[model samples]
Target: MPFLDRLQHWAALRPDANAVTIGAERLSYAELVDRASVRARELAGESSGGPTVLCRPNGLAFIVDFVAAVARTGTVAVLDPGWPALQRSAVERMLQGAGPSTPPAAAPADLRDGPSDSIFLYGFTSGTTALPKAFTRSRDSWQRAFATSAAWFELGADDRVLAPGPLSASLTLYALAETLSAGAAFHTLERVDVGDALDAVAHAGVTRIVAVPTVLRLLGERGLTSGVDAHALTGIVSAGARLDGATLASVRNWAPGATVFDYYGAAELSFVSARRLRPGEHRTGSPTAVGRPFPGVEVRVLDDAGRASAPGTTGTIFVRSRLVSAGYAWGDDGSAFARTGEWCTVGDRGHLDVAGELHVEGRLADMIVTSGSNVYPQEVEVTLLSGLGGAAAQVVVTGLADARRGTLLVAAVVEESGPDAPAVTRADLRTAAADLAAPKRPRGYYRITELPLTGAGKLSRRLLAAWITEGDPRVHRLD
Candidate 1:
């Protein structure tokens, strides 16, 4: 079925039901359909093809703009509307090109490769893989994501879902569409302060929330977790990056009644695997394990030969699902990464445990080579946090330059609670990692006040590495 069909069906099926609520603004299914249709009509009148840069912030406008674009069969680039003006201006230049009078096409004319039979609203990966390729997301692909992923999260019509993160981020965009598919009310947050997010959720009477782990850390660090009285929340999902054991434990403790679903999925692949905290399960765990995939999804670990590896054998993870993205658009032709008829994976490295649960080690592209051994940043980050520093609020691990060793591992961390205000010395952390694999030990350490996060609140390793090398003037420095 097409994307608009889902929205139209929901609106017609339950017109009186509350469809959206955004900071004193509310809309029922009927109102949302009417408004969104008008938006669709407006966008359809404008242009030829490609994507419309969804320039609005993370609120009712973002949702309305997205729906309008989709209904018009025009692609949309969901960007962090809160990006620094310089960065945003750069994006505007890149996307919009020149002045409106002689404006370059929204997308390259040749960028359109898929069959013109049915065009769509695909998002571009921002400098993520191979210079930010575009994913040609068909209407069927994204709609199935809403249909199937709903069962994985167990969303229902009565649920009030909140995507507090920016609408420009893929996760929030998917959550927005999926919530509507399940016939649930979606609440939009214009601002993302920890206090404001908590209050917004409470005010909206939100039952489910999808956010990155960084937001949880900020909420925990700011002490807003203690003040929030959002008893209505049933589930809180933390994704994008691994959540430290202590950080995960604290969030669970803060919202004792709510179930926490920590997931790991790549943008190229839809929902890879998720672990929802059950009643008796431990809250604090090694972040490596992201648990099992949803029912319809299939995961395989392939060696360098692209052949399936034995259980517990670490290799690249390839996912198969109808909901997964189609091949990315490149110069002239599109390239499919490890894909079959209905599945595709974004080069994540992992292995399945004896229990058949998936444990994502790291991104294959992010693997660090030091001396003779290859290092996975996720493993090192977990190691540094668990052994050396002992539960830092946030940690980003990557490879650093070295003339002698070729390349060395480096870790940047932030402490949530410590008398030093920044505890966990670099020497201590390195010594800890060295105990496990000294050859691949981190040579540099830095304490940052506020870690840079992507639009979806995930830690940006690119920015983290740049900060360590350039010596972030804003953060306290320690070499």
Candidate 2:
């Protein structure tokens, strides 16, 4: 059965159980099913070929509508509610003439006959480009993801999941579905507020947190000051980006009793490699080591010839699993996902250790070949962040076209905040980056007021690359 059917089953099993909560509002399993049924009836009434665009902010309304659309087999496309008006308008214009018509009535038969292979979601990839790529997911793909996450994360009915990011983000959206499918209460904020999240954990008995590392770091910092009972948090899952050792240790210090997990995955490829951050597990191998493959998922580090590379050799990372998406929908960029026989790649460059642990270098397009050596910006950034201690606030390493070296490795630093913010110089950064090999260490350094960030709070390397190539007023040369 699909996710909604699983939810209905849970509703039948636990009608009065709390299904979802957002601040003061709470929905029991019965109420959730009823609301979704009403919404599904409305959606079923609609003409169903085209996708259903869910552009609303995160709340009970979005959840109900999403579930209803899924149940009615209307391909649900989630849009970032915080998208710029111009971008939103452009997408709206492109979709205006192609949307489905209204149906006469909600058909109950439509719900029962929907096949697992049928497309249910229109997920957009988070990119820095002008337009995002839309990808389709069959019910089975997400259903498989639900199972894998439940098993790997060891989720249960007793767990109360707190997903603090926007629901438009696939990580949080999958967390919502996974929480419901596991018959657990799902909690989220309409917008992420660290104070509100802490309150929920302290007062509302939120047991698990599914969030990006950046949000986790903020929560950890607050938890240190505010004093949250670590025992209240059962598990914390960090996704969307890699967590540096310092951030991981801070979160561990705050939630010592909770099992902290960080997974490396993309929207197109669901759950990939995941690792637990215990005390001694911090410095395992490479900073990029993201742990072993998820349950029932197979990964390969293949060279240009499409053969598996030797362990520790970087290559194109290919995934073969039912959890992969049904491929791109509208904007099949042709660069992201490529198929070779049975396996497919999402353009990520990574490798497997001799022990079979996956270590991600960076995105294939993001790799920088400078001074006759290939440098992964993530490796350089990780080294700088770790070596600099608290000196480096935020660091982005991007390659700029250079006349001498072909590509110049530049490190942009957002120095620590405050009147006593350490006056870091290019010399200091060069000395701090000594931990990295000669080739990987950044040659140029710039102290900036702010690091360019995506709307989703991720480091916008593309924007930084642009700012480096074409001068930006925000940047200051640290010569």
Candidate 3:
């Protein structure tokens, strides 16, 4: 069943149960349905059943508006609330111009029986230009993903999920939808606050947390020091960026009862692969391993010629699955996201090991060519985060212009802080990266107070590069 199709069932089965919670505000399943129905009627009366723009901050209202828009129009565009005024206006203009010109028939009274193949979501991905690229997904794709991810993670009606990030982010939005579809309670913060997130896990009976690695790290550290009880947390789902070994260790220590899972996915491709680390189980394999393909998904590593690459041979990663989005709605510059027959690739380069585990190197656009050798920054960043043994809280690798080597590989690290945090130095980082090829190693190291992140909370390599190029005072060079 589609996501909204299950809402009525949940409302009937658990009318008084909390369906969505943000901060202190909450709506029961029945209340959620009623509010959404009211909003759906309001939406139908306001505009034609065309695309609707949702640019609100994380809150119960955003959730209600999203469901209402989806039920009424079946097409909703989510924009970051933190976007600059100019960018927001530009995106709104683009969405307005791109929507259907003719008005569709009146919305149905039920509002929950839209066709499965109808496009329900329009998500934007960070782009090279001033405006982000918009991508659309059919209701069927998300319905399949909701089922697959819920089953994979063992989410059920008894679970209370906390996704403490902006709902505008795809990861958090999907978490809310997946939890609601499973007839479970969903919790989030109006603004990302570690104290509030810890309180939710401690006092709200939150059974699962779905967030990016950065938020997870903050919550883990704060929860540990504040003595917040996380025994109710059964699962920790990390995505949007790679989860470093230190953060994973801290999260395990903080939430000893929960299993930590790190998944690799993109906005265009719903879910590619995931790996789970059971409580008390230490990761013992390749740092880049992202586990097997998700159920109903086929992964292929294709060389430049489009033929499947040999095992352990790095190539462009492609996916064949029903979860793939219906391509871009607009802002397609052709720099990423392409298809060959039934296989789709976003130019992410990776390889499959002998055991069929996928290891993502990095995106082709982020590859650095230094001294005639190609280097993927993700591999180097992973090496620093995992190989350094809790020495760095975060790591970002980028390339700077050079005279001799085409590009100079550099690294910016946020050193682990606190009484027990390990002491590290430039020499230690170099020694730890000995396993990497000489060309792949970072030639320069810099220290920063914190990792630069985008509006969505994912680490922004573009911003880090800009910082280095502009000689930002926040970034301090290390000898």
Best by the lDDT measure: 3
lDDT of 1 by residue, 167-273 (tens): 77787777777887778998867766677777776566878878887787665445443577655667888877776676666666666667788777767777778
Model 1 alpha-carbon drift over 4 Å, by segment: 1-3, 72-74, 80-119, 128-131, 220-226, 283-286, 331-336, 340-343, 371-373, 389-391, 401-408, 418-422, 477-479
Clashing residue pairs in candidate 1 (N, C-alpha, C atoms within 3 angstroms):
none
Cα-based lDDT at residue 261, candidate 2: 86
lDDT assessment of candidate 2:
0.79
Residue-level lDDT of model 3, residues 1-479, one tens digit each, is: 25777888889888999999988899999999888888777776676434778899988889988888877335788988788888888888877746532223334337584677877788988643478888988888988898789999889999999998889998989998999999999999988878888988888999999989988888888899889988888999999987777788889989998999889989998899988988888887787788899899999998998788999999999999999999998867667788778898889998999999999989977888999998989989887776777778888898888999989999988987888887668888898789898899998888888878776667888788889999899898888
Best candidate according to TM-score: 3
Better of 1 and 2 by TM-score: 2
Worst window of 10 by summed lDDT in candidate 3: 100-109
lDDT of 2 by residue, 399-429 (tens): 8889999999989888765688687778778
Which scores higher on TM-score, 2 or 3? 3
**TM-score for all predictions?**
0.86, 0.89, 0.93
lDDT of model 1 at residue 375? 82
Clashing pairs in 2: 45-103, 46-103
Q: In candidate 2, where is summed lDDT lowest over 10 consecutive residues?
A: 96-105
